[model samples]
Target chain A: MLGKIKKETAERWGYMGFKSLFSSGIYFNVFAFLGLVTIAGLAVGLHGTYTGYHNVYGVTRQIPWGVLISGYIFCVVTSTGLCLVSSIGHVFGYEPYMPIAKRAVFLSIAFMLGGFIIIFFDIENPHRMAIYNLLSPNFTSNMWWMGTLYGLYLLALIVEYFFLLDQNHSMSRLAGLFGVLFGVAAHSNLGAVFGMLHGREFWYGPYMPIYFIVSAMMSGGAAIIFFSCLAWKIDRTVLTRRMERAIMAVCQLTILLIAIILFFTFWKIISGIVSPEKYIAIQAFLTGPYAPNFWIAELGFGLVIPFILLIRSKGINTNLMFIATGFMLVGIFFMRYDLVLAGQIVPVFHALHVEEYSSLLLYTPSLHEISVVTAGILIAIVLYLGGEKVLNAHKFQKHAIVPPGAFICQGCGGIHYMKEGESQDDALKRHHRMRKVDREDEHA
Target chain B: MKLTNIDLEKLIPENLISVTKMERRAFLKIGLVITGVFAGGRILSVTSNVSEAFASGKDFVDQYPYKPHYSMVIRQGLCIDCERCLKACKETNSVPDYGYRTRILTKIVTDAVGRKREFIPILCNHCNDAPCTRACPTRATYKNKENGIVMMESKKCIGCKMCILACPYEARYFNAERHAIDKCNFCWDTRLSKGEKLTACSYVCPTGARIFGDMSDPDNVAYKMVHQVEKQVWVLRPESGTKPNVFYMKATRSSPWDLRKQDGAR
Candidate 1:
């Protein structure tokens, strides 16, 4: 098995890189150079804030937290969902998803690495973030839990990926499952950061965590489609039939979760109307200054368009899948922005609180804030592409197809050569019993 | 006159109250002496209790035990939003440009009518049950136990923005550049630590609209203001159950429903 995998890796990457090094080396180098330049520019700009100006923070007293935190949370939640979906496919007895398992593990690490970069920039004091969380833990705080869990999630993913590479299936499966659990914990805790706030009338509710989790799955589903298409574009084989079935199931779940999101959105708007604490702000969102962004950007582009595309596609057509995924990704970004900004737009001063919905305490992102958010996205893309290139992290074998001869049980890699009287179940049961007997015989 | 061990034992009342049914007359004579000594001891204890209560209450009233670190406890009715407090704070602290540490929040009641448009200077309340302190994940925001002042260490903050949502007074401000939370500290570095007068806002108020002193100390300006005025007070959002220390004098039903009260039912 080790020799087979190493031979395959050498064939795929060695040929690809040797060919690219001569023909497309300049193209690859240009992208690599651009990535380096972007990082350098970001570092320089951030460093210039030492002149006693508040350039690093996109916050003011009126709107203290800006886009950076919201974006960071979005990345982390998305990464968590990816890790979970991938782990279920790889580590557990979910044989249907086995073909895509390796790729999933690889992507899980890449996405999490992307999340880490965003968080690193968001913290005011990054150096203390590591030691402080351990030495002086605030167990009550959701952010602390989110941070700690994400850290654990990262460790699990790395372990899971490496063991798979080493062909240590038992350990890999255990690590993968552990990663999934921690990923869920981390994602939900991040959502709870907003949901647990009692004073912010807009954010006070039980739904934010659900909203975050489902949206993450939606983005995760879209991300899989996007990445899978990229795989095909680069001439990698189609995923195994069983893995494709699992991806299809995720697509259905994605649609269902989106429907749930719609229901929550409607009720959320209604609750805002009735709540005395939030009524003024609710009205502001409906007909006030934020109405355009709330309606056009968040609801129209993010929700409605993506919903229509996803429902129409039914998870089958590759082109539709790509289009739907793109729509949802764009929409999710808008949704995050609207969620972050709308709550603070309404001025807190009661006397100044307008009777009718009017403009909010207006704010626009500063250049520094924009640059930082852009940097986060760039980091995610660059890391994902680089990981794929180096690892030969193809999720499926070249031209992987369900040919007539492909009816082998993934559990034992045995071809189902059914005897005249035997049923599928009987074959499976016999296989299971035989394997156990053989193990006992070896021990005896 | 110094009693030895034998003399001390004799002075004690242990043998004074010996009783036997046939010796009742003898017992009554001993009982009288015992009762006399016991009464003297009771008087001494009662006097000590009174003195102890008085001494503690005096210090409590003087507001010697508590101090504000970063937050100020505001009295709403006393404020006219003269902007003098704002100006004074800006000038004194060399405050960097972002938002005011001490700023005024106005609530226009009944169509901004002259009688109904209420403006109160809002800052950090330094609450006994501070929501920010409770929500902070790092324990970066803390309450000073000795003086009941809510304090924050900016150097330790991660800027997650959870405290902004948890604060009832909307007291927390974010330093955009530093990515740290910021708010008023009642001029602790300048005023409170030095045993000086009230903060910049209090000192600037010509109408004595904002009075500052130890609310714990009855002799202090804060204690007297609250006691003497007989004014009804309000907290911005007590429904949060933060037990805010800041009082809004002459507050009415117009104030938002207490969040702490509403939350308790849940």
Candidate 2:
């Protein structure tokens, strides 16, 4: 299996000549430029942090968390979503999800790393955290579980990707199983980090953890459509009939997920308004400081506009799919941002009527904070482009992705393997024709 | 009025004896009527300082979470915003200029006669159910099980600041030098651990406004002051459920509010 992959890799690399690399398009060049700029920006952010976060970050004592935390959650939620959506084909053996497996697995790893980068700069004494998070393991802490599980999830995914590359079917599936288990645990635990904070009236509840998983699937579905479109554009490959069908299926699934999220969001707002304890926060997000974030990004772009476009296209238009998914991806980012920031904006002592806390605590992410997040995104782009070049992720054999026992092949008497240099249907046809020739030879 | 629980045998700190003998006798009657003073949630509704003293001193002596439930009582009527306690705390703890371990809050209420001002000193609650301790991911901020003081383990802190948000008192702040969150630990490190009987703020209060003592010890002045059932006792933001160790009352004697304590503490 691995030998077959090596031969395929060589064939793909033969086409990737020095001239082809240098003659990359304007889009590729922009990503390269972005990568360099963001790297420089990340260095500046780190330097500012080293001097003093108080001076560099816009976060005050009243609001310690800022856009950095929001961006971290955005990246991670997308990563978890990709893993779950991709596993539909790789682990569960759904043919429609098969075309996206390789790209999905690749992007999942890339996005998780991006998340780690954003958070690494935001946390003070990150070096100490690395040492103590292990030594002084707080078993009850949701943050501890989140960090540890994501670490394990990353390792499992890397192994799964390696196994997939080797075409080690059983081992890859086993690794994928581990990846899914830990990914779900880590993602929901990330939700628990905020959900468990009873002191935070806006965030406290069971909804966050459940919403995280559901939204993860939605984010995953949208990401696959968006990136798959980009991959086709980058690799200059036309989407085959099968690949287009796969994307359409995912598009429909994304539409449904968005509806679920809309329902959840609607009820969340309603309940928050009904509960007087959380009324001030509801006001803060809906019609107050975060109104634009809630109405424009989360509602309009994230859910409403994208939902209408996908429905109008009837899940059939490729360009419409791309545009909708792109909007969803961008809009979902603000969803995470709005949630994280809104939770902390209402000062804990707001009810006390103190002069110090007479108004809502103000916070705006400084330029340094924004730079670090931009760098994290740039890193994801670089990692993704690197994966595409090195792994030939776009060239995954769609036929081979079918999970065992999911379908009984009508061709070749229900058998499901191909001979050397033969596609699944061609191998079955050749074998059937040979049997008929053998029978005629016996009659003669 | 013979108050059954007002035991006179207790050893009192000199600073704790702010009220005169006549005021102490009147405290029992004052305590009986002040239970409803906090109902309207206005400082002006409290009327006389004697009534506030009556309301603040109720239900103290019976309940104690630890052997020496380290506690504090503030006589709000006597506070003149001298900021002596704040200055003393800064000196003792090396608190930076931008940060403080303790601060004062002011409220002005207008009556038919004129506008009256009240100052409330705020500090860490050292709560029995401390939200900060539970919220700290690294157990960096923890409650001292022995003293019930919420203390910071600076080295363990990653400066997550979750504890700051969790603290209903808004008492915690980021200490850049320590690379951790800083808060009032009831002078636990600066004075209490060094065998000092009083917190810096309580010791320096010139009008004898701040009372620091062990609520669990029957002989402590704080225990005596808060034990009367007739007087209503309340903590700030009781709805928060922190069960703060700090208590508040009004001065029994009608002394004018002034910055006279500034020279005494510095």
Candidate 3:
């Protein structure tokens, strides 16, 4: 049954077999190194799980979350952002955005799976979570909502990708719509998991959910540009005028998002300084231990420098976009790390004047924790590389002849009947033009 | 004598009725009232007061959600850093040396008039609106409906440690042996379920610093103390709005030594 499904899928989607994975020496070498790193990371994670997370991880009773949690957040935030950005094209019928739809969808799924793998190691009883998360669901819990919604989002994304590969645009669009909804809901709830905790002065606010969604869009935009540029490097054939335009559009969106994030950060710092509870945590970012992370990585690499680079590139230079996005990805990773650590460092009892908790608590990720986080990144890279090879770099035909009978349009999902010997591209254009005329007539 | 070994004889109970009046007035302005004082005027004594201590908007002393709302009242001033409670709790609960189910926090006031140091004993607040319970993706840590003690199902715990971060009191720790987040459950499985009225910490408290009882029973000392409206009482980190079941208040040295014996005799 598995062989039959694989054979049928290969025939339908034109999947390249296992031998094709090792065709290019550079690709093979990169994959081999990443695969080894991923395996080592997974081994370390399993060892930690078997021994005890407490013994292996840097987390303590004071700071229960560490770099691994940040890593997981980074993955999911990027995944949700990708889903949202990609949905704007394929699901919402945006012409300029269509070319990126397939690659973004594939990466979103890969990143989400990577996130799950990281969180699985972070959780002590991950198996129990799978069981009780369904059996004894806690509706009020933000964590529960986040887990459930993300799970649904992943499922929707998988279905959407499947239909996209099968060339069933209507089905893919339906699944993509659900994927977008679930992704947004899941991502916001992930933010609420931190935000709703009134005890955590640093994280407790309405800002977290809103910021997470906005930052997700920024991260998503950067990821697509970086990966597309990388894909172009790997296979020059993938870069058509349509693909170039899509990347340019995404670059512009990324620039806008970076500016918005900077504005959010500025306000976050300004507001946090005045609030007595949040002052110490905010100060840590401004001039204390976390100053470098905030100033150099989060602001410089994640926002300011990328903003400048993208503007200089004029959203046209793929090489500059690549360099800018590379810095952005690194900066975004540190942004998540700082967010998680800052909230926890200000010991819960800091306000109570207890000698033990008078100063900020410290946490440095253990080797095992670092390995697990590395594995998550490697998993995403490996999956993306594998998808590129197997799915012919997620290429879609720009022009084709229309078949007989009514077919669902990729853009509008509207059924259009084609005349004999008519081209698919012309039919779509004609349908769009007629719809524009109808819309104009309605306005009149 | 060293400060650790406090001399009970040298301690004088300063008449703070004026100060107490001011505190009561301050509390009253915020719609709260003091309840009961214990240990007959000791410099360090246990008191309990309640007026909507739970986050559910229900009158904690009046409505009493649980049939027996198990609660702990820490006499903040009475804790002498003896640490007998810690030892007893560790032994009873099999708590590892690296982790604790209960702890004493030392706050030294360099400019205080009489006492320069204060020991604040802390444990699970067992909040009626438990953030840990809410934060747990799985129903691993949940507040008991019957008695209101926050109970843990270790098997169900996915050890996300969300509960640890959610706890305002810093009462939880990752128990490597259990492979789950461990916390003070008022000795429910070890003592309370085994027909003991007090937790190991409360029973072994030589200074009667930790008082454990069912606040839902009006006849019970915990309930009577919380309902009387006499002495000033407070809970730690009230701004978190966890609505903790644990109460804290000052005690006098008038009869500090007799508290344990008196409660034991009851």
Candidate 4:
């Protein structure tokens, strides 16, 4: 009975079939290897859990958050970004943006799941957090809000994806709207988790929330382009002309957001130098131990080099875009690391001028921590690959056949009339073109 | 109150009033007499020598919200690097070897002449507006309604360590055995709950360095010491704006050790 239900569901969803996952090929070998690494990493995390986090993790009383926190941030930031960027096309109805929407939604859920897995290991009493989060919710806590909102956002994303698979555009659009709302709120709260800490001078301010939202957009734009490019490389049929246009559009957005991030970084450094408490942490990034991470990874790859490459590519060169985004993903990972660690390197009592706390505290991620972080990245990749095979590369109908009484315009929310034998795709394109002409005429 | 015998004229020149007005005002308000000026008067070393115990202004003593407002007052200068408080606290709380419920921080002034070494003993400040309590997602660590002691519900702790990062004072540590964060709870569990008047650290302190009592009670020594204007009473990291229950004041050699005797008699 279960087998029959599974087959029926698979047939309805247009799954490529489970046999595709088991087929012998380079992709299969790669998937198997990633599965192995993920298992091995999870095993290491479990070992850490069994042996006490204190013994396995590098985090001390001074530096309570470590690389695991950064890893989790990296995953969720990308997930939020994906949700936001994809919503611009699907939820809000931009035709060029629509091509990447389905895959982006799937990847967003995958990345968020990766984030959850990492945090599950990082938290000492995950079971307690689950119970008390509902039983004794602290409304004032940014952590609580971030966790709860992200959980809801994930739910919205899953529902949205399910409806999209069913070709139920209106329901999918509604879910996507909720997903976007929850994603933004959750991401900003994650920033508040760091920003609201008055004790950590480096992270304290309104800057973190704003930065988080803006950077998530930047991260999202780069991610969609990167993964979309990878998807095209994996299978030639996946890259439609519309999808290419969508990647180009995202690439342009990525460039603009990167410039904004660069501007934010410049002011952050200057302002940090002026504040006595923040100066110590900023100094660490400038010329202290984290200088390499800041100069090479965060500035060079995260902002500068990617900015130059994307500009040179002019959102046209797919290969260059691919390479630039790969560099960006790595750089952004370091950016999160620097953000979390630099805020904590200066001991809390450093201002007291005590002999014991005079110097900046140091932390190096343990082998166990590295393994857990590795697992998080692999989990996202493995899920993406699995999603591709199961969801038939997340391809949708070129032109959705609008059901009777379902032809309301997505752009203006007015009823759209289709002329004799006019397809939904052509009607959308014509309407958008006419709107563009009207906008241009108004500008003239 | 008795003035110290150290000749102020010999230590700081008569013309040392060239110090900044703000510095002078701060010194006077704290009842500290300037003892040494160095680095072209950029650095000032001060010692308490007030003969009269000034009545604390009403504005300085805010109405306590908690009935007991359990508090600790650290006599900074009197601490002589003695680890009896540390030893006693560990024994009472069963603190692990790697962790400390309370600790003494040493500050050395190379330029100062008379007292070069000062030890500051620090524990959980039990701040009225504690960042840890605010940051805690599960309300695992919360301020007690009755006494305002920041107490931990260990079973509720998820050990995300957000509280540790939020704390301005590096007071808390994750206790692996309990699978929760632990810190000084003013000996409420081990001593105070059992009707002990003093915490183990304060009771074992040789020089009355750690004074534990109710800040809300006007008759309590902790309340009196914090309320009085005779000495420089300050909390660590005041800029953090935690409004900590723990207070600090200097204990000069000239003042006889009457506070310890008073507590011992009790």
Candidate 5:
């Protein structure tokens, strides 16, 4: 299988013609394995009868919340991030990103699909929730808005991707516009879920919406780079110098975002020091049970290290960029873990401080929960890879590339040939000859 | 009526001291009854004169003031932020796994000492005027007429997050898994509807700090305590006058006091 892929990669690189990567038996086996894992995970998750753990389960009265919430946040946050990057690239006319725009759109859709699956496993009665959200329509609820917006956003992304695939630029642009707007709404609402929780000191406040948006943008950029680089490597294709420059710019933006995130984080911790209720939360992240997670996973691995790697003025090294991305992904996972766990680690009755508190108030994700997260990640990779492979199968190459020539037009600028190796001057001459031939044929 | 020390001593002999005390008590009662009858008519007239005051205000048992029956109230001071109540409520109520019925909030106040300190507790003040209900487009979350508890029928929720924004105190939570709104309802199903005295929070309170009772019934433990304990009390984010049912005898400066403070924390 490795030899075949290498041969195919070399052939594709030499422009000798590419094969259907997904059609191979080896690819089928990987897909089958992923499907099996998903099924096993779902079975384990559904085997439990209780929505929350009791005395028999790992979660105790000391820690009410567990890993499920963090996983859900992870899926949704990634989806939001993908949507933002895709929309900005396609709709905003970021000319540098034109080559990757369609792939980004495809990724946006794939991420949302994965997110829905994760959330589906977490729900106690998904069917009932579906029926109720549509039938009952609780307009006042934040979750309601989030659900509605995500649905619409997904639809918009789908439309945009299809339009792009079909080369319907006008329709694609329209869909992209709507997708961007709804994407913003969906992510902001997701943040409001935590922000509106006046009860959780860590989650409360206006900055939640802003934090979510900025993080989404940063993560989205990181994802695009990571995935794009991977695709380029797999296909043995070098990105055009222009495309590489754009990727560099994206890396710069991502670094700037990390800096902003750091500033906000510093302020967040500092403010926590002043307020008693939130102080407990800050302390948990700073030096409590989850302190190691915060220091190492979120700060050291996710932000600090990634920041150092990406902030170089000369530009990021491609290999180092991938490493940083891996670190950020790992770190972000921990950040989500800390966000959910720190809030619940401290018991409600710490005021009395009477009981001998157990340090094991901590919870590890059940096999089922971990399986669900794994399924989401698998789904994203498989979907993205499969789609790219299929498109490549259909992407016929030109023997010789032709550069565009400038021409005057009334409504828009130069109308160049959509097909490769075709010049506008040749097209115009061909049109005139066809017209003259048609006149002679009519006279005959 | 003793005429003098010598005369009184002569009238009430040392042997008859107990009997004399009983006789005087009877005489005092007789005098009180005569005055009560006359004062009853005067009190009726006074009630008529203070009709507006009577209409708006109920009489206080002592120097303490009367608090109205708020639909959603939280005892912030007594809350220990254990989150047990949130879990119990979620399980008993079948709240979505990724959601919460109540949240534990913590506030940090930095003082001139240049060091930071904090206070934390669970909060779900069933407000007398709930903003969540008002913000709902479909009215999925409604205040119960029976106990004034705000209940949400998940089936009807459309997953619009408007209510989350409307809540001034940020009491609402989004069940991302279920795609519905979930929040504390004073344990209406297992506790309030069953005529149970208190919620899980009040039950799990090891210090007996949280006292739950009918505000209308003066004899209720919560009512009596509020009146008896002359401690300074406060409400979370007092500016959002939703008239929360929950009261705190003493609120910390570090607590989330308003939208501004909440924003600052984030």
Candidate 6:
């Protein structure tokens, strides 16, 4: 089995860098170049963060956790989302979600790697966090639990992905369960990382941990819709009825979670208004500098627009689902950003009515900080395309309709098997709801 | 030296403040009382158990949590905003130019007489119920068992800055040189541990504005200063329930300068 995967993977990559570069077409080349440029930007960002982050990053003693931390949160949130979303079908044996398992697992791994890469630059001495984290464990810290659990979470995901690729069902199922446990634990603790803080009144409460998990589900559903739609467009493969249904189910979930989050955000604001201690921090997002991000990105684009779009689509319009997912992904990015930044911008001494801390603190991410975040995102995209180009075919082949011997049967739910017609993808499209794409794209 | 309840109108001189206690009702001087509001460039005592349930030393702690029961008392009225303690702390601890170990806060409260700026010096209160230590994951910033000083073990810090967010006073800062969170440790590394009787800030406070002592000892000057009923003394953000060791009191000696009642629910 190992040798079979090795052989297939080697052939898919063209067995040579120059040959693969020359052969994959202009669009592939453009994507690869974009990925490389992002890496270069990452290099420059690393240099800045390393040489003197104080001089380079827009962070100050007042606002230490800046955009880089926000970016890290974004990636990890996506990773947790993908893992939980994928596990519904793959682990719990849900039929509609089964075909989504492989791509979701692969993307989840990619997203997590992106998260780790961004956060590595946030710490002053990343080396020390490694040593002291294990040598002197502090079970009390939310960050400690978050870091350790995510480590375990990553390992479980990789194992789950590997088993899913090999079609070792038992092993993959076990690994998927572990991944769910670790992912959920890590993501909630990430919430507590903000929730547990005392002076930062906006985030200092029980709501954060619960909100993180629910939002992770919302994110996972959106990620699947976004990536899967892009996959159908690129692979040009007429999505099997099962695949479409799976996406619709995910869309329904995406909308539900968005509604839940919208509810959560509403209460958060109301609660803030009622509490004087929370006045400055809450005021920042409500009518202060961060108002634009909260209004446009977080509320409008993130929840309301996509929610209306998805509802109107009736969960069947693939185009509408794709568009809504796009808005959600953008909104999710700001959601994490606003969460991290809004909590920190209120200077700790603001309540004391000191001249030094009278106003809310300001932190606009520097070019280096922005680049590091952009690079992390670019890295995720690159890994996604790379995973698609090399691995999706063999994994998806069995699920695609090969039109066995011209007998179009609606007896099965997906791909009515060309019932009594000529052997062509065009012939298959005649009965299929989606248009003709490619076997090379789907089963290359 | 507990002063029994009295008609504060008779106690304080008429020019500064006039408080009249009628049977059960205490009438104020007809000053505008702003409840939970920030406006007109004035900040009232807002952290008044704002949202959280009130926490106190007796209710929050079962017994003395620390060995020394270290504490501080600031004579708020006497503080002329000299900032000598601030300078002394910076010099002793090598606090960076941008950061401070201690600071003085001035509130220009206006009444019928005129504007009177009251100085309230602030620092790491080193609360027995320190939120920073509780929030720290690695115990990097923990309460020192022997002295009750909240200290930082720089090496153990992950630079996550959870402690910074947890501190109500915003006492901690990320020191690039140390690559860790730094804060006031009551001059533990500089003076107190070095056989000095007082912290640098207390030692250099020429007017007895900042007093540091062992609260466990009743004879300690700091204990007497806070416990006395003749003067109104209070700690900042008592609602925080950090049960901070530091106490704030006004100078007993009268000055010609215009003032208000310093004893408000002390």
Point to the candidate with the largest lDDT: 4
* DockQ of each candidate relative to the true complex: 0.24, 0.32, 0.59, 0.68, 0.10, 0.44
**Tens digit of lDDT per residue, candidate 1, span A1-444?**
332455655554322342332234654685587578558646743763453225555565556556766667657766766766665556665545555566666666766765666666656666766766776678888878877888898898888777666556678788888887887788877777777777676876777887787777766766776676565554445444454566576677677877877887899889888877677677776887778877886777667876787678776666777677776777777778778766676555442353321345666766666666666766776665654554554544332223333345656543444455777667777778888999999999
lDDT per residue as tens, model 5, A374-435: 77766777777766565662131221112344332212222334234656656655556677
lDDT of each: 0.64, 0.77, 0.85, 0.85, 0.62, 0.77
Question: How big is the positional error of residue A409 in model 3, measured in Å on the Cα after superposition?
Answer: 17
Task: Give the residue spans of candidate 2 off by over 4 A.
Answer: A1-28, A398-444, B1-63, B110-113, B249-266
RMSD of each: 16.4, 11.6, 10.5, 8.4, 16.7, 9.2
Q: Model 2 misses residue A171 by how many Å?
A: 2.1
DockQ of 2: 0.32
Q: For candidate 2, list the clashing residue pairs, or say none.
A: B55-B232, B60-B226, B61-B227
Q: Which stretches of candidate 4 lie over 4 Å from their true place?
A: A1-12, A398-444, B1-62, B254-266
Tens digit of per-residue lDDT, candidate 6, span A1-444: 323446655444222222333445865886779788788878988789668787788987778788998899889899999999988987886656777888888889999999998988887777888888888877887878988999999999999877776666778889999999999999999998888776567887889999999998898888888888887776666376667777878887888898899999999999888998777778888899999999999998899999999998877888998899899899999999999888878776666665666788888889899989989888888887766655543245343212345432332344344445466465555655343245445765
Weakest 10 consecutive residues, lDDT, candidate 1 chain A?
Answer: A13-22
Per-model chain A TM? 0.80, 0.87, 0.90, 0.90, 0.79, 0.86
Q: In candidate 4, what are the lDDT values of residues A184-259, reduced to their tens digit?
A: 9999999999999998889999999999999998999988989888888888888766677778888988999999
Question: In candidate 4, residue B123 scores what lDDT?
Answer: 94
For candidate 3, what's the TM-score of chain A, rounded to 2 decimals?
Answer: 0.90
Quote the true-contact fraction of every model.
0.50, 0.39, 0.88, 0.90, 0.15, 0.60
| TM-score order of candidates, top first | 4, 3, 6, 2, 1, 5
Alpha carbon lDDT of residue A338, candidate 4?
94
Worst 10 residues of 4 chain B by lDDT: B47-56
Whole-model alpha-carbon lDDT for candidate 2? 0.77
- Candidate 2 docks at the CAPRI level of acceptable
TM-score of 4: 0.86
- How good is the docking of model 6, as DockQ? 0.44
